[model samples]
Target: MSTHSRTARSGDRAASALAYGVVGLGLAFLAIPLAITCLMALDARTFLGPLPPPALSLHWFERLASRADILSSLRTSLVLAVLTTILSVSIGTAAAVGLARGDFPGKATLTSAFLSPLIVPPVVIGFGLLLFLSKAGITNGMARLLLGHVIVTVPYCIRTSLASLLGADKRLTEAAMILGATERQAFWSITIPLMKTGIITGAIFAFAISMDDVSISLFLSDPSATTLPVTLVSNMRAAFDLTIAAAAVILMAVTVLLIVVLDRLVGFDNVVGQGLFRS
Candidate 1:
């Protein structure tokens, strides 16, 4: 081979090596904390110590099982997340369709209104909702939490769904309608299928965000109805313990399981590729 060709080959190999090294470092940065948390939770020792824990046990998990308050918080978080996901996806999808397909005055303004939550600080949103809901005579704690979560998560759905709609082939829906399919039929059969990738991607993101939210949950949560993240924060204030780590692991596991189930049912790669990574 020529010297120039050999030098170019050497440079390509070095670049590939550097790329792989960077990716490995990025993975390590993300994984190390989670690994530490799991190890700490499993540590047989009651007190926090150096890495590897010296021993391993399920003592923290057992203690976590005995904590009624934490368990109740977990249940509350799950219910709230589900409700938030449903409401946000519905509202956001509808809003996205309208904003994308509708031609009317102040369209840009309306789109901004829907997405305002993303730019606003969570603390501000939470406090504002608290006062507004209180004055509106909506005193139910669960209702308040649900509303707060839906507001925060709806923006993500709108963004994903809108992106999908923008890239979709409108001719297919028109073709269906021309073939004697009613507007609703074309929408449900043609447009919905086209929009599915965006909708599902948005729903997953909405679910995860709702599950992990603490800032809005903090203000909206009552003693009777509080999310797990908020409860964990409160517990940390009162006492720091390994049970917290166990609870965190449980929360992480639940999120992962739900995502896996979704991937199995809907093919997450297809959904994400079509929605977020589409060229």
Candidate 2:
């Protein structure tokens, strides 16, 4: 081969190696803290210490059962997340259908309005909701939290559902209608089935976001009833221990399980592409 061609090949190899190294470093930066947290949870020592603990134990996990506050908050978080996912997806799917299939004045403005929650800062949304809901006399903690989470999570549902509706084959619905199928029948049998992936993807996003939300939950959480994230933050302020690490690891495991389930039911790549804006 010519020297110039050999030099170009060498440069390409060097560039590839550099890119791989950068990616490795980025992954390590993200993964290392999680590794440390997991390890800390397993450590039998009373206090945080160096990595690779001298002894390993499930002491903290066992203690979690006895921690009534933690258990209650966890249950609250789970229930809230499920409710938020259902409500967000329901509202979002209906809005998506209307936005995608209808033509009307202020349509663009309306779409922007639906997605505005995503652009607005969470703190601002939380504080604003707190004031608005309190003045409206909806002072129940769980009720307030449900409303705030729906607002935050619905935007994701809308985005994914809208993408699905826009990408779906219009011909199928039209054919159904031409074959004596009413619009409602065509929507239920044809459009909804086609939009299933998007709906599922949106539900997953909504559930995950609702579970992890702390900022908004903090503002709306009642002293008597709190979500896991808020509970964790409160405990951190009062006291910190390896039990916290265990709780975090459990939370991480739940998130990982969710992704695994999604991957099993709907191919991860397809979900990511359709739900995460790549579509």
- Candidate 2, 1-279: lDDT as tens digits: 999999999999999999999999999999999999999999998887877899999999888778999999999999999999999999999999999889999999999999999999999999999999989999899999999999999999998888878877779999999999999999999999877877988999899999999999999999766999999899899998888999999999989988987788767777666443433
Off by over 4 Å in 1: 1-20, 271-279
Per-prediction TM-score to the true structure, in the order listed: 0.88, 0.95
TM-score of 1: 0.88
Q: Provide the lowest-lDDT 10-residue window in model 2.
A: 270-279
Scored against the true structure, residue 118 in model 1 reaches a CA lDDT of: 97
lDDT of 2 at 14: 100
Instruction: Give candidates' CA RMSD values in order.
Output: 2.5, 1.8
40: Cα error in model 2, Å: 0.8
- For residue 219, what is the lDDT in candidate 1? 95
- What's the distance in Å from true for residue 232, model 1? 0.6
Model 1 poorest ten-residue lDDT run: 270-279
